[model samples]
Target: MRAFHNTVLRFAACIAMMLLASFVPAAALAQEKTSALMTPELLEKVRRANNECFACHSEEGVKKPPRADLDITKLRPLAHDPKVFNGSNHGLMECTQCHGQGYTEFPHAADARESISACEECHAAKVLRIEKQLDASVHATRVKDKFTCSTCHDPHVDLIASTLIDPRKIVAQDNQHCLDCHDSELEFAKFAPDDEQTSTKKKRPDIDKIHEWLPNTRVHWQAVRCVECHTPATKTLSHEIVNKEKAERQCLTCHSASSSLTTRLYRHLAKEEQERLGFANSVILASSYVLGATRHPWLDRLIVGAFAAMLLGLLIHGLARIVARIVRRKKNHG
Candidate 1:
């Protein structure tokens, strides 16, 4: 019985050893494959190849001379700064990722635009959401030539969202994107070459001049987002941007107890927190307030009534004093 037990233990040991040995080759194969694909030399070769493509597309590449008929502003559109491109969010991605498969060769195929990948290819959900909003935007409904994602954003030069976290800075950047086309004389000409309504010489409104009625116009623009005024009042931030003319511009729109800024600007704050920091609280916390955001309806009416009563009392007192003075003067003259 002891010898039989020893033999059974030896057999179990042998089985375990065989299983361990079987996994060794598989692990080695996976390591070998990973090393082959991700060697330092391979990475260097990729960097070199990418630089070659940038040479033509970037500022260092051949600068194309402006055609006799071509507008000067249009000429620089093709030129890029390689340093800027490499620093962008898509910097590490290969040129072929968007340019397409055959674009690696010189004098690339004539149909390269067909090969370029749509932004929706990778950002399906985000693109879909923005598309729905954009479709319903004033830009889409009013303009004959509707704007696309590329119209406002340059994929090659635009920075990642993670890098633009400051609310004030973000607003300024977004507003600048709008001004780029809307403010550009050349852009206007391109949009409507034949139409006299959109004359190339016509300049965009001066930000301060147009918004002079708003107190501290420049400061407000810098501190607050253009979308805060331009977009229709909504809780969710989206691409449904309205034209300047349709924007909610009434002082009461923001100053009233039901200010949109209360919800939109301070949206990160919890409902309880917003309530805790009522109208005066918002002013105390942020040095700003929308007049009605925290106002009590009864209190507001009481204050208005009190002010009116005081003014009426003063008017009656002044009239009585004036009559008394005049009567005295008439008696003395008589």
Candidate 2:
């Protein structure tokens, strides 16, 4: 009997171990893979190389060209804020990994430019998904070849908004991408030029005048991303941008109790809060107070209960006053 009990316990332990091993690999595979960090020795070498590159590539350095003979018009602005890059998703990477080792020496080799990596080279999975989305976007239909990732995203300083904690910060970062093209006439004309037959010079529509119908436009701009209205309401973090005419304009779409913001702008926050607190719209309540949108069941019940108690108290006081008046009248008559 003792031997049989020990055998049963051992079998159960083996079953538990097998189940854990099966689930562990599935969980690991679900997470996105990042670039491996360099060894300490290699990291120190990369740091020294980055410092040398930054000497000429920094914001102040870009203002003064290294060679007077070089054509200024041909040189693209390579200036970037090191502090911003350090806080970005690509912060751990070595500059040479993207720019090439030839940059270590002045006057880079003719083939060094060819060595520069494309976003898709390292981010095959993510870029593949974005490519599909871009294919369906209005920009793709209008400017077939001109629209690329860098058109909206500045690789040097772009931070993943989903990783951020503050919703306002995410809104600002995402909106800046849209505003960079839509708000700037020069940028807009690159892809969305006016009809040459009608107008000699390209002119972008006034963004403020276009959005005059929206109430508190400045507040809405600060609180939500442009994509919240531009993209399909069904998609979360969608890159398929709709045209201005097709953009969402209904106030109830975002201002109602069942606001689409929960699935769109605040999707990440809602998902996080749902996992942690079991409340879907708690994120909006915690972040910003939106009228008609930030409703809580518990708070609603409390308000209704208070109103009912007040009405009941008023009715009781009226009845007591009538009974006291009758008693006084009866006593005086007797």
For TM-score, the strongest prediction is: 2
Show the lowest summed lDDT stretch of 10 residues, model 1: 26-35
TM-score of every prediction relative to native: 0.57, 0.72
* Regions more than 4 Å wrong, model 2: 1-42, 63-76, 101-105, 110-112, 194-202, 274-280, 304-334
Candidate 2: residue 58 lDDT (0-100): 71
lDDT of 2 by residue, 183-290 (tens): 998788777744659855457778889989988889989898888888876655778898888888888888777888888777766665552243336678677777
Error of 2 at 313 (Å): 10
List CA RMSD, all candidates: 16.6, 12.6
**1-334 per-residue lDDT for model 1 (tens digits):** 8535543554453344334333433333221211233346754664577777766665545454322443335335566676666544454445665666447675567775666666766555788878878877866775537466777777666653324434454556667777776667667445433335764444545655677877877777766667778777765766788776777778776666556654665454324344432333353135343345556566667899999999999999999999999999999999
lDDT of 1 at 120: 68
Q: Rate the local accuracy (lDDT) of all candidates.
A: 0.59, 0.69
